[model samples]
Target: MTDSYDRVAVVTGADSGIGKATAVLLAEHGFDVGITYHEDEEGAWETAALVREAGKAAAVRRHDLTDPVRAAHVVDELAGELGGIGVLVNNAGTGSSEPLLGMDYERWRSVLSVDLDGPFLCAQRAARRMATEGRGGRIVNVTSVHEEYPRVGAGPYCAAKGGLKLLSRVLALELAVYGITVNTVAPGEIATPMTGQEDRVPRAGSRPGYPIPRPGDAREVAAVIAFIASPAASYMTGSSVFVDGGMVTMGPQAAGALQSGDWR
Candidate 1:
């Protein structure tokens, strides 16, 4: 309420991992933050405490983005609580390890709804508010290296992220006139709670598949997202900033070069 220009960011799935890192980093950069979590209210408050420790205000909420309709409404609710939304990071996502052919219909629908439809709803709702209020916004979708590369058992995740990447570009083109910038951040092999590797930081000898020779930290990816959400990115939109340690560029040759998997 201090100024219409006061920066406020809403990051979904912020209870842990990359989303948590993003909220904390944005706070460090002087943005009031709103964090949403599906079931980990405690983790959400932990993130809030980190934000407060960084000298910024934080609003925490319980959100399930699987419902597109409810997803938009949640954006509206968060905006109301945070004064206005300057940045929206659609980071809530889920993955399926089930094989593509054997995947059930409901399971497939669930993935698409959360990863694609939900972001679409939130983007539409937030962009409308930003354009209408005459305050442009920043939307950074947390996609994956899978947005460009297909994995063995992650067909649904690949499809959803790929769709979101294209959708983000379209939104970037459409929202540019309003001064709103939209972009995608594709991270590869990040060390986050999602990978069940929070206790193990990426070591110099690990992650042989990466050119950098190690998995990235969540903060590493969050830094890229924070930059894109900042005013310095005023002229950049419809872009995909990759934080994949050269994973995607390595191509099939990289996977083919992999010497082993646990089963092997």
Candidate 2:
């Protein structure tokens, strides 16, 4: 039997963290991968090496998704290099936590540029390429738990992520005609270099608020993404898959509920 991902996939911010994990996983699943990095060409190369190790073709490129023109060029180049793009993973993002009262317009806009606008532009370009190629595609936006719920001091991150959720839905609805599926994969606290390792334990210990009672791993999130980007997920689109281990369902009072409610 032939694999569903014999084509190609482009994963942005693939230098490290969940982006890196997803890129590696997809490559392992028989998809040639285009790995994009901002300033970390070495990291991108490392990811490419892993893709090559998976017996898949790999292309490493530099892209600053915050710049629309450059981002478009990056997509065109990746499609050219990879032969064609079968999947687009908008996983490039950064976040900062600060009180809304002290937030500057520049910082807020920066967050939106990376977390929201970047994905939309990349997805639009990739979707157009897929539509023009007359072959269906998958677009997965690596969003966050804050996409639906708000957290303290993370106003900008929350705003951008929330916007991305709707963007994914809108694209999903419109792209359905083109046989292209669009969806969001929202993850909770996962242990990644970006999440500050020294503080990871403390953050995870607070997971009494999480129904799973434990933090997740990058590989776990990667697996979820790989599935979403596969042919098996054909009927799934315009949806946000929460890989948060049931944290979103419990809300902030989850800890209180767990502490006071039945053990069974």
Candidate 3:
């Protein structure tokens, strides 16, 4: 899949939250973007507008990542629409608030399908295209702080992200022969609609357990992802980058390891 679009990037779940910020940031950095969202057409259009505002081409797709075939096809579809793809950001994911014992089997499956299977399929599809293109590519997975440690009431989420972290390393090694770089970006307490705090900036006391004094902004995480997708990160792969404002490094005590929800 090749197109006239230069430096095109594919960002899943770009309708809102960190995905929205990632798409817009990639555009600002001279990448035409193909954004995907599930059940949020309006939000997808809004994100596309941001990409266009940055003087880059934008395309939107409604993606349901539960099916492996469909998950992979979205990347191909978006790459076709955008002309080509140079970077792939697997930012689409879902979490379960129910504890493990209370969580039904369907709920567990839903979380894992979208968070793990979907990204794996998407990465495989995107990697093949990049390798075949012979121009090298960037693959960045947007994981979570749970990837490093357990989160209360979020067993499925933690499992999926932890799996993805390891998957990034495997992809990095497998794709290295093709000059493709794969990495994971783990974020903590980001201000987004997902956290139900889109209207306000992350404050120091918002997440009292965090030592940073403020919740992280979506843009902060996006910036780090953009760097990993850039040529500047050519030498990095099989590594995990934390955008948690020192939350992960602070250990469980200082960061309130027992707390769940947005603080994680």
Candidate 4:
């Protein structure tokens, strides 16, 4: 295997939020980025412009993770345009807010397919290419705090993210031989379109329930991803890093201070 990989990265869902920040940060870190968007071609172009502004090459494409088979090919397409992929950030995802009983099979399946199945297929394709080229690579799956903690109304989202965390671990173990590291970055409530907080900056006292007492910024989550994809994290793999502003640590405290059963 090659000792060092190429400085090329493919980030899905780069049109906005964590994906966009990650792509730009990676570009600033001396990587040529391949950006993909679902229905935000304009936003993707904006991200591409920022990448080029950072003095790196940027390639944009439309990637619909709902169609996992076709979407996974976007990896190859970007890799072809960028020479090779040294990093794959599986950041495209969807979520559901209805209770299990209220959700139809279609809703549940849609979340599972995009949040879990899409990453699996995309990782498979990227890993195959990395292995064939004999260059080590990095795979970062952007999950959620729900990956470990359940939410009352997000049954399908939790299930998919939880499954993805385990899948990342297995991939880390299997891909280690090829010098590919797989890890998951689980974030709490961030100011992103997914959280209905797009273009909003998190204030210090915004979330009193959280230990940090505020929503996280997309850039904050992206920083950790950039670190894991860099050579500095060479010894890390199969780990789940939580950029959740201590939200995961507040479960017991929150439960103890609950004033009512209204939480249910």
Best prediction by lDDT: 4
> How big is the positional error of residue 209 in model 1, measured in Å on the Cα after superposition?
2.2
Residue 164 of model 2 has an lDDT of 96
Candidate 2: the clashing residue pairs are none
lDDT per residue for candidate 1 within 205-232, as digits (tens), equals 6867678888898999889999988988
Would you list the C-alpha lDDT of every candidate in the order shown? 0.88, 0.85, 0.88, 0.94
C-alpha TM-score for every candidate: 0.94, 0.90, 0.92, 0.98
Shift in Å, residue 67, candidate 3: 2.4
In candidate 4, which residue ranges exceed 4 Å CA deviation? 1-3
Better of 2 and 3 by lDDT: 3
- If ranked by TM-score, best first, what sequence of candidates would result? 4, 1, 3, 2
Provide C-alpha RMSD values for all models, in order.
2.8, 4.5, 3.5, 1.1
lDDT of 4 by residue, 168-234 (tens): 9999999999999999999999999988886567888979999889999999999999999998888
Model 2 over residues 54-139: C-alpha lDDT tens digits? 99999988888668556757877988988999899999888978888998998888888888888888898998988887768899
Candidate 1 Cα outliers beyond 4 Å, as residue runs:
1-6, 255-264
Pairs that clash in candidate 4: none
In model 3, the worst 10-residue window by lDDT is 1-10
Find the candidate with the highest TM-score and give its number: 4
